[model samples]
Target chain A: GDSVTQTEGLVTVTEGLPVKLNCTYQTTYLTIAFFWYVQYLNEAPQVLLKSSTDNKRTEHQGFHATLHKSSSSFHLQKSSAQLSDSALYYCALMAGNTGKLIFGLGTTLQVQP
Target chain B: ETAVFQTPNYHVTQVGNEVSFNCKQTLGHDTMYWYKQDSKKLLKIMFSYNNKQLIVNETVPRRFSPQSSDKAHLNLRIKSVEPEDSAVYLCASSFYEQYFGPGTRLTVL
Candidate 1:
């Protein structure tokens, strides 16, 4: 069985500060992809970033994540966090062409101004 | 900005009652999926349909079923709702990256 794990339950940061939400996964499949989805209050979760290449960093909307196959981690990071960046972040895993996703317990990011 | 749409943002029903949630996607995706988000914000895939054919079915209860009229629509129906079924039901469509619709919150009293 494949599983994703988010170590942090809730991460709070002051506006403009650096932020990181840890995400790791365990899978038996060799070809796997990772994704980050953000869900705001009363909104649907959207794709923030995704990666399938190992050790390659992917960035979108100022958020960046690098998938490291050796470590089995794809931690999301941002240099400067904004107030609007507050949301529930989920780390997902999908194997090959299978569209079904295995999601982790989401991490709620709260940015305070 | 989401192309996927779900009807009835929220629904309140009683135990043993039947409930159905409708989902439609205009993204022209071949695959549509149903996901359940529990109170803890843990998401789990319940069902997935590709080209109007069932492809993935997780170990869900027999009372739960997925109805897809076509590639753009996938509806979920619960034969007899249970208190444990009270959660957010999300509809998504994808060929690779999934696009989600605003979830429908279900409350079973």
Candidate 2:
């Protein structure tokens, strides 16, 4: 079984501040892949970052996340949050042969200027 | 830069009617998937197809079916739609990372 949990429902941050969106996953398969997707209003979810190798960091669009197998987490981080960075973020896992994604409930980020 | 395309960007239909949505992928990938996003903005996997074989989500109702004529086309059909079925349906393709279509917004009244 594979599942993802992003415990934050909403996060409001001031511009230029640091931001983190917590993501933790549970998987029976040892070989698992993690992904972070960003979905803006009226648009489909787009892949922001992904990583399969544990302990390695993956980054895109000024956001970075490290897959730490020891902690079973791949929390997303941004050093300087911008207003345009506001969107709903989802953490997903690809664990089995089906290639089906197990997605988190999502966390909404609101960046204030 | 888009690899997937979905038809019927927006649809409003009666609760008891049947509706079909089309999805096509040009990424040359063997796997395609359909996901549902509810009004709450929660995403859930609905169906998947690989090399023309259907893999449906166990929780999906029998009334919801997937039809694939070729490796690149996956169409979704919903029979006797319910108000709860109103949501955004996204089509995606996977080649290590999944690429998504713009999505089709369905409104069941």
Candidate 3:
């Protein structure tokens, strides 16, 4: 069984501050791909970033995440958080082309101005 | 900017009733998935159809069934819905990445 564990339920940050949403996973599969998805209110969760290459940092929309297989982590980070960045963040795992995602409970990011 | 469309944004039905939620994707994707978001906001995979074939059936209950008529459409039918079935059902398409619909909210009384 594959599983993903996120930092916590709620993460509040002041606007323009650095943010990091921790994510770590456990899987029996050898090759693993990880994803970070953001879901706004009443909206579908959209892929924010993804990576499979271990130790390589993947960046998108001013966010970056590195898949560290040795550490079993793919923590999402942003240098400067915006108010609009308030949303639910999910970390998911996939092995090969199965397309079946094992997701974490999700972390609600609330950036206050 | 929705590539996926789910019919009946909201539905309220009594227990033991039957309900269907339709999903269509115009993204020209080969895979479509049904996900259940519980009241606690924990999203779980229910079913997945790839190229109109059933591929992944996560430990979903037998009461819930998924049918795909074509590559673009996947519908969920719940026979004799129960109170525990109340949740937001989401339809998604996978083209390397997943594109999701707004989701259908199902409430069982």
DockQ of each: 0.92, 0.87, 0.88
lDDT of 1 by residue, A75-111 (tens): 9999999999999999999976787798989999999
Q: Model 1: per-residue lDDT, tens digit, B38-85?
A: 999989899999999999999999999999999999999999999999
By lDDT, the candidates rank as 1, 3, 2
lDDT of each: 0.95, 0.92, 0.94
Interface residue Cα RMSD of candidate 1 after superposition: 0.6
A43 Cα displacement, candidate 1 (Å) = 0.4
B12-107: candidate 2 lDDT, tens digit per residue: 999899999999999898988999999988999898888798765658888899899998999999998999999999999887789899999999
- Model 3 C-alpha lDDT per residue in residues A1-113, reported as the tens digit of each score: 68899969999999999999999999999977899999999888999999989899999999999999989999999999999999999999987678889899999999999
DockQ class, candidate 1: high
* Worst ten in a row by lDDT for model 1 chain B: B1-10
Alpha-carbon runs more than 4 Å astray in model 3: none
Model 3 residue A111 CA deviation in Å: 0.7
Off by over 4 Å in 1: none
The best candidate by lDDT is 1
lDDT (10s digit) by residue, model 3, range B47-85: 999999999998988999999999999999999999999
